[model samples]
Target: MPPPEPGDVINYIYLFAHEAAAGRDEGVKERPVLVIASDAMGVAVVPITTKGEARSSRSDRIPDPVARAMGLPRAGESHVVVNDVNDFDWRGHDVIDLKTGSFLYGRCPPTYFQKIVRAVQASAALITDRR
Candidate 1:
């Protein structure tokens, strides 16, 4: 598979803030993650969650139409938690394929992606760089 690019959404075993704080190296669940940036060092991604209460003040909601366009599961509302990002190798073992036999759900629209980027820049969230 080709290297992941910004805007790509993929299922991954994303380590949550609480988990990492507790000294856990592995995430308990596999969920969707938005690729925010990538380079020779690794990739930076933010977790997407359907649980509204889990979202931080520095987050962006994915519109219903945009979520559908991105092929996200029709579960419910989704939000990208900009306050919590994870950095790991580009081809981390935590990355997983969807049921459809692919590692990607779809790409986030450029416009929406820009909004996310802006949020991230304004956020003081601590990045969990595990590279």
Candidate 2:
């Protein structure tokens, strides 16, 4: 099948804030990320991190099956870091462009993407106060 699009999964290099301090040089290397949205500008993504020591409102463990479907590395277990979400431009970042064969990872199903979106929404709402 074709690779990830909007509402799909992808392998991404999530650069740390400190790493990007000087420029987009250092980063955590390859990690799994969910494609929440995409446009002419770039893609809005949610990263899946291996750090599970602490659970936050913006993080959730991804199901094994979903991870497998998404072709995520270390698919057995992982957590999606929603609060760390960011948009990356195609030109400025090293992304897996399926059309150009830039990177050769696969994409997740829409059902799984929907689940991730819901989790992100829930996390976003968790910080809101009705009072």
Q: State which candidate has the highest lDDT.
A: 1
What lDDT does each candidate get?
0.83, 0.60
Question: What tens digits encode model 2's per-residue C-alpha lDDT throughout 1-131?
Answer: 33347766666676543344446554557666677776665677777777752334356776888777766667766777655555666433546455445553557677767777776666652211101
Output the TM-score of candidate 1: 0.91
Which runs in model 1 stand beyond 4 Å of their true positions?
Answer: 55-57
Estimated TM-score for each candidate? 0.91, 0.68
Q: Runs in model 2 with CA error above 4 Å? A: 1-4, 16-26, 53-57, 96-104, 125-131
Count residue pairs with overlapping backbones in model 1.
0
lDDT (tens digit, per residue) of candidate 1 on 1-131: 45689998989999977678889999988988899998865889988888753623356678988887666785358888888889998688999988889889888989999999888888876688777
lDDT score of residue 3 within candidate 1: 63
Lowest lDDT block of 10, candidate 1: 52-61
Q: In candidate 2, which residue pairs get closer than 3 Å at backbone N, Cα or C atoms, i.e. clash?
A: none
Model 1 lDDT vs. the true structure?
0.83
Best-fitting candidate, scored by TM-score: 1
- For model 1, state the Cα shift of residue 124 in Å: 1.2
